[model samples]
Target: MDTTIRQQAELATAEIAEVAAIPLREPGTELVALEAAPAPVAEAIRKRMDELDMTNTQSIISFGSAAQAELQQISQAMLADVKNKDVGPAGDSLRGIVSTIRGFSVSELDVRRKRSWWEKLTGKAAPFSNFLAKFENVQSQIDKVTDDLLKHEHVLLKDIKSLDMLYEKTLDFYEELGLYISAGEAKLAELDATTIPAKEAAVAALPEDDKMIGSQELRDMRAARDDLERRVHDLKLTRQVTMQSLPSIRLVQENDKSLVTKINSTLVNTVPLWETQLAQAVTIQRSREAAEAVRDANDLTNELLTANAKNLREANAVVRTEMERGVFDIEAVRQANEDLVATINESLQIADEGKARRAEAEKELEHMEKELRETLASAKARDASSDAGASVPTA
Candidate 1:
């Protein structure tokens, strides 16, 4: 039993020493430091925490408590066994010391347990309230960013849609312009095909007389030739104007085509890609917020546990000092224990408030998530409809 007690004490002492060596700041202090410090300093702190292999501070406290309890139990049993063996003065003195220490350890353990229960009841809000606030703030900022991006996307889509309609109208106009130009060419061809040839034949059939004959046939023939020449000259001038206008129309059509291509590219590729990336950014930010919340909660839990351990150690020291002075204070111990229980109960009430707050936060998050999902679905449907419309054969 003595050997077992010695081993257990040694193990407990080592555990305690290990925990003490870790430079754990008070709850929320690290978060504050992180917020206030420069980027490089914050990053360095993060790196240091990672190197220590201390992902969860609560685990350290739990291990320390378990080791301490094991040590206390072994020591108690050793003291009892020594009393039964009829040990001498030296052994009696050792047993007395062990009994006092065991008593103090038991009281300390009870207080620690009460404190732990209180902390658990309060949840993360007690020690890490600022972290919760920060999480909410980040979420709000992300929501704003998403809203702004969606608004811009909506405007872009609307403009692109309008551009697409204009492109189709421009194409139809180009076709109509081509038909108008073609009609002018056809009119010119008709003159060459029938009227010009017939007129030339008539002029050739006329007698090559130098004298102005008073015959009606000569006058009618000359007049008809003159009328045909005027018609041909007017047709050529009209065709020249129409032909000149073609290049300007074609230039406009080329510009329309380029504009259409650009709008289509933005709609099909750039806008969608941007929306996707924005969604991913929101997701990443939410994930980061969640992770920070968890880490902060763990830090708070560890802080509470450490405080409990310190109190326990102090209680043990007081008991040991009183024993050396040949004094005991049973009433004071009882009062302290009662006060601790009352404090724990009050903390439990606070915990209820925290739970309520947490529930409200969860509901808000759910609503936001639903909104985001619907928005994404709407965007996808719009994209799909646009694609289907684009693939259809135009009349």
Candidate 2:
């Protein structure tokens, strides 16, 4: 790139780099809380579970209890048949019981594991009934929460975009306002363009009045009108202001750039210091749908947020419970993922090699995103230096 283009590129790079350097502590309170969520994904899962509860999900899993009892009975019958060496129809009956026993085993285990999943797929399989029984409402609750969260986020994004669009529209409006000033200026400029002889022409067009008496009143009125028009014209002519120039395009891309900078600085840079503390404040778990809805139910103005908050708390509790029960370290894993991504990005500023590596990654991302990327390439190619020299104004 030539000097000006290079400067633009450098500016872009510095902005991105600054973003990369941003500390995690600077995120908005909402995003920070979400990042620190005990089980963030659990929020989505909880919504689905809630919907399950609304349908009287408990009634749908009645087969789970019966299935378990039947399995135990079948096992008892099979044992008796085997001991007595029973044969014929009675033996056949026991064999059938064995088959049913096998079916019920999975059902029993599923209910014990995750009732929501099992019940949602209820009746499709004899097994997993128990797992389905466990959640009683997992999918429904998860769906509800997921929908609500996505909806809330979408609305916020739309609001920001609407404001952004209005900002652009306002620029356009101001542009038109500027032209009014220009129109006035043009009228004034006309006075400079024309000579006083042009005014005398109109006066000459009138009948000779030298011999007439009391013609001064008519002359005075004519002069007064001419003077008023001339002065107004002069004022407009001096108003040489042009249309308002468009702002730099970079300003268009930003949504509260200052806020972005501040948040990035706090969130990314100070992550190590605050991550542990954040982890302590939150919990994480996957729980049943019914349980989540109950936990999420809130009396707040936004039923959605209130519900989400409740779901968040329940999800945190469940995830925490699961973490303890299964001895799984959720925080450690989350931290590792977050830290690794951050480190890779920060390394770009350290070395030229890193920049090239990141460039390769960027290309890779582009390729992955597009199976066919030839749309813009159809434009005719030109000599790079010649084009750069051309006065198209630097982008």
Candidate 3:
């Protein structure tokens, strides 16, 4: 990784290390209360045991009962708090914010690119302004989510402190258990070493007939010590619970503290940085769009001016040429006169050919008429001759 990132990681590790250095009461350390006492300690311990209520099991177990009950409550509270306070949703929201940031882009912002002519002239684009409004709304949402996370952090910190107190309470219970066990052991040792032996010797000195009755006190003392031993065993069991609970409390507190640290970092470092970068990106994008719009406007203006100039040049050339011309040009009049003379000459030639064709057609018609009349007269004469011949020779 980068050196800066490495340094940051080291710093974070150091902070956690410092926290871990805080002393915790090690399991079974309370056993030291039962360590070997000095030679003179037996007499003192015996006197102390004499003051205790050896026969009352209820009184003996009271402190242990209280310790166990409180430990149980603490454990339950820790479990319930762990179950009820979920950081998952907050973490998911943070991840969602990251995804949103990654997905967001200036180009995704709605911008009316094709504006009216008046809008173009006014140089007013609503895209950036609208983006600002939307960004403010999104910022509000981010703030709300962050605020909830901050509240969760506060609750976790408070719970962690409560767990610290619980840890101390567990240690106190452990020490109480050790004291009860040690005191009970000392009493047991004294009963075995001194009290029971003395009682048995006294019973031995009694007459054989009364020995059984005389040993009753001894038996009673033994029974009381047995009850004391049982109570101490109960206390030891309670201590075992406390031993286990210490680490559980610490682990829960550690988890809560770690979540608090993460939330602090997100709120103080990551979020502001992300927002700042986003704002800068938006500003840069708007600047780019503005620059592009100006360039496009300038290009469009240049194109229109060039086209208008060309059209104006062509229009002026046509109009000026038309203005310089006469109403009727001499070349046009001369071409018309030549065309009229050729037309009249072609008409006279066409009329003469028509008259000659008509006169030939009349001569042809007269010749046909004469031929027809001559053929008819010949036929009529042949018919008369045939008739006269047929009548004279009536054969």
Please give, for residues 327-353, the per-residue lDDT of candidate 2 as tens digits: 547888899999999998778657878
Q: Which one wins by TM-score: 1 or 3?
A: 3
Candidate 3 matches the true fold with a TM-score of 0.53
Considering lDDT, where higher is better, how would the candidates rank from best to worst?
A: 3, 1, 2
Each model's lDDT comes to 0.45, 0.39, 0.70
Q: Which regions of candidate 3 fall more than 4 Å away from where they truly are?
A: 1-30, 33-52, 66-107, 110-134, 201-224, 295-395
Model 1 lDDT tens row, 69-92: 443453355446432222133234
Worst 10 residues of 1 by lDDT: 23-32
The alpha-carbon root-mean-square deviation between model 3 and the true structure, to one decimal in Å, is 14.6
Question: Order of all candidates by TM-score, from best down to worst?
Answer: 3, 1, 2
Kindly report which residue stretches of model 2 are placed more than 4 angstroms away from their true locations once superposed.
1-150, 195-197, 208-395
> Which residue pairs clash in candidate 1?
none
lDDT of 2: 0.39
Name the candidate that leads on lDDT. 3
How far in Å is the alpha carbon of 272 misplaced in model 2? 18
